[model samples]
Target: MKAAIFKGPGAVEVGERPEPVIQEPTDAVVRVVLGCVCGSDLWYFRGESPHAAGSIGHEFIGIVEQAGANVRSVRLGDLVVAPFIYSDMTCPHCRNGSTISCPAGGSFGNGTIDGGQGQAVRVPQAGGTLVRVPGSGHSDEVLRSLLALSDVMSTGQHAAVMAGVKEGDTVAVVGDGAVGLCAVLAARRLGAERVIALSRNPARQKVASEFGATDIIEARGDEAVQAVLELTGGTGADAALECVGTGQSIATAAAIARPGSVIGIVGVPHGEVPFTGTFFRNIGWRGGPAPARVYIPGLLDDVLDGTINPGLVFDYETDLDHIADAYRAMDERRAIKSLVRVGGI
Candidate 1:
């Protein structure tokens, strides 16, 4: 087997790894068809966050090569999507809509477990962690979109849902990364009449527009906040979504949200939130790691039917051999997202 190895900050290499096999009766071994570099991975690549020196990707869709005796939800030869984290869907936290906190859950590609970046992965709790695609012979475009459901799309939808976006509500998304762009789509899907995307990149702005953004603000910090406020007639956005975890982005989201509004924050926080200011303004916040397992089932139909094409976010494509290039493209900002074709269906 072969996979991407995270040697250290600024270093990722393609190398041979032991083939994954069923480790428990509840496990399944998946032959990866497609994998993608996530924005969150950049945090490790840039040395801004810590990552172990081994298998290191978390988003992928593949075909089940082997299923354990206890894995009844999916069987061999079934195409499936593995969320970034593996959770026991029966756990109390999962039942409460917080799969990320499932007592028996754990993240993939955290150094010990075989990651989706590999040719195959040993999926623990496969019955609860893997979402089987309903049909076969899915087109390339559709497969890419399916891969997005493993993380970005679900995370984006979580932000919108947490913020209580409603029909005719004005929404402002602060971030133009793949997740942010998907947040725009999620807001529209939830019936938001107006979506303002904060982005300075022309390519991202185009995608945001296609995803249902009604406005694109080419400003940051105070300027961006003012622009969102002016667009909302000085009342500020009915709901502000923070898709970047930086201090500036958090502050911008807080500033642009209307008083008494709740801001949805899904970005991996890298800075402190302005609790005092938001409290004083009657602004609340809600959001964390998206329970992708919960959202995947709801979003799958949309992808299969082409109601949305979140795969448009993958601007760069590569194979497992050049895994390093996949990381570099996203790290250098040359691609919004990098899709890695791992194996055939």
Candidate 2:
């Protein structure tokens, strides 16, 4: 099998890896049809974060090629979406809506695991981890959107869910990456009447607008905060979704949220949250890596129904053999998100 290999900072290569097979009674081997480079993947690509030197990538949608005896929810030939992480939905944490914290759960493409970037992946806890796509003959556009449900879309929804976004609420999103853009869509989907997206990139701004951003602020730091506040008539947003984990991004989120609202944070934290500042304003914060497995089902329906086209975030595309180019495009910001076509349906 061919897959993306992490060769340390600033280096990603397309190389051969062992093809995956069913490893457990509950396991399923999925032949990947679509995979994409995540913003978080850049952290390691840039040496800002640590990643093992093997299979890398976590977002993918595919057809089940093989399934162990215990894998009943998904069978061979079924198209499925694998959440970024694998978890037993029966765990206490998963049942409580925190699959990321499931004691038995772990992420894919983490060096030892069969990553989604490969031709196939061995999915553990297949029954709980893989969501089968209901219909067949999905178009390329729809398949790309289905891949988004594996991570970004679900993560964006998590931010909205954590921030308590609701009907008639005004929301502010602090990031313009794919997840942030999806956050804009999620806010609107959750009935937010006004969505303020903080972004300086014209392309992203366009997508944000298309995704239902009622306002676009092209400022940064305190200026961005002021802009959001001004848009809300100085009362600040009813909710703030933090999709970037930088100190400035966190501060901006804290500053722009209304006193009684909560901020949903899904970005991998590279900086600390302003606890004191938020606490003083009676604001709250919640969120982490999205429990994608839990959100995929509902989001899938929307993707299949054309209610949301989150796949628009993927402006760049490549095949498994050119996986390195996919990573570079994203790292250079030449593409908002890079989609890697792995195999045929």
Candidate 3:
């Protein structure tokens, strides 16, 4: 078998690796059908992530080739989506709908767990972590949307939920990456009356509109903050989703939110936030590792029913052998997200 391996910063290669087998009673060996590079993957590739060399992917969808004796929710031949984090559903946090932070859960691609960017992956807690896809024959578009259910889509939904978006509320989203674009869709699906997106990228602006952004703000710095405020009358948005983790983006989210509104930040923050400014304005902030495991089931239904189409975020596609190219494209900002076909249905 072949897997994407990270040798060092700015380095990823498709190298021969051991095939996965069911190692636990609750595990399932999945024949990966589709996998993609995540923004987080860039962190490791750029040497910014703390984890050392290991398998390089987490977002994926696949067909179950085999399952351990205790696996009950899924079986052979089932097509499923695996969350980036694997969790035993019975844990207290999982039961409370915070599976991503499950006390026993851990990431799948850190060399401790077989990563999803391979021909096959052994998924622990299969019964709780895998969401089965409904049909036999799914188009590329459908598969792409289903893939989003694994992480980005659910994370975006979490951002909106945490931000307190409500029916008739005006919402603003900071950043135009895949998560931000998906946040636009999530806000729309959640019933925000007006969706305002802050982006200067033409490609992202187009996708944001398709996802239901009623307004696009192309300004930066104070101009961008003023633009969002102007769009929502004299007040800032009722809620704001911060999809970028930079200090500047965090401030932008806080600056563009109404006095009593909340800012949901989903980006992996790299530095300290300016809490003093946020405290003075009375703007609440919430969000961390998105409990994508908790939202997958409900969002899967929406994907199957055509309520949303987030696969549109995958603007580039390639084979697993070309995984390096995919990373380069995303690193260069030439692609919103890249999909890699690891195997077949």
Candidate 4:
């Protein structure tokens, strides 16, 4: 089989690799149907978080080729979606609906297990980690949309949920990346009356509008704060969803939020949250790596039922052999997200 190997920063190649096999009774060997490069994957691509040569990918939707004896929830030929993080659903955190907090869980493409950017992957905790992709067969668009349930959509939804978006509330989303756009959609879906998106690109601003952003702020810092305050009648947003992890973005979120509001840091934080400023303003903080495992099921239903079409975020599509190009497209901001057909499905 051929798989993507992260040899070093800025170097990902498709090369021959060993086929996956069931390594545990809770495992399932899945023949990947679709996989995609994540924004977080850029951390490895840029050498920010270095990794020795190994298979690398995390978001995937596939068909179960085989399952071990202990895997009871999924079976042969079942189309499944594997969240970015894998977990045993029976663990205390999982049972309580916090799968990412599961003590028995780990990442999908941390290199010990087969990564999703390949022909097949060995899924640990298969019964708990795999969510059946709904239909026996699905159209390409439907499948693409369902793929978002694995991570992007789940994380966006997590940001909104953690920020405490409520009906009639004004919500501001920081960042214009795919996750931020998805956060806008998630906020609207959760009933926020007005979603203010901080976007600089016209294209992304259009997408944000489609996803329910009633207003778009194109400035940063104090100008951006004034924009939000002006939009909300000088009160500021009821909650702010911080989708970018930079120190500046974090401060922007805090600045645009109303007093007594929560700022959800959905983006993987790259710097320390400014404490003195946030503390003095009485702005609450929450959100981290999303518990995608717990959020996938309901989001899957929304995808299948046509309530949301997050696949629109995937602006470029390619095959496994062109995985490097997919990575480059995302790295260069040429694509909001790239979707790859793993086994030509």
> Which of the two candidates, 2 or 4, achieves a greater lDDT against the reference?
2
Decide which is better by lDDT, 3 or 4. 3
Q: What tens digits encode model 1's per-residue C-alpha lDDT throughout 246-294? A: 9999999999999999999998777889999999999999999999999
Question: Which pairs clash (backbone N, Cα, C closer than 3 Å) in model 1?
Answer: none
lDDT of 3 at 215: 97
Best first by lDDT, ranked: 1, 2, 3, 4
TM-score of each: 0.99, 0.99, 0.98, 0.97
- Choose the strongest candidate by lDDT: 1
Q: lDDT of each model, Cα atoms only?
A: 0.94, 0.93, 0.89, 0.89
lDDT for each residue of candidate 4 in 91-120, tens digit (9 for 90 to 100): 889998788888878887777877889899
Q: Which candidate do you rate higher for TM-score, 2 or 3?
A: 2
On residues 102-182, what C-alpha lDDT tens digit does candidate 2 reach at each position?
Answer: 888899999889788889888889988999999888998899999999999999999999999999999999999999999
After aligning candidate 3 to the native by TM-score, how far in Å is the CA of 309 from where it should be? Answer: 0.3
Candidate 3 lDDT, tens digit per residue, 1-345? 899988898989998878888888988999999999898888878777776676868899999999999999988999999998889989888998888778778887887777878888889888888988887888888899999878899899999999988899899999899999999999999999999999999999999999999999999878999888888887999998999899889888888998988899999886567788878888888998888888888888888888999999999999999999999999989999999988878
For candidate 1, what is the lDDT? 0.94
Residue-level error in angstroms, candidate 1, position 251: 0.5
Tell me the deviation in Å of residue 16 in model 2. 1.4
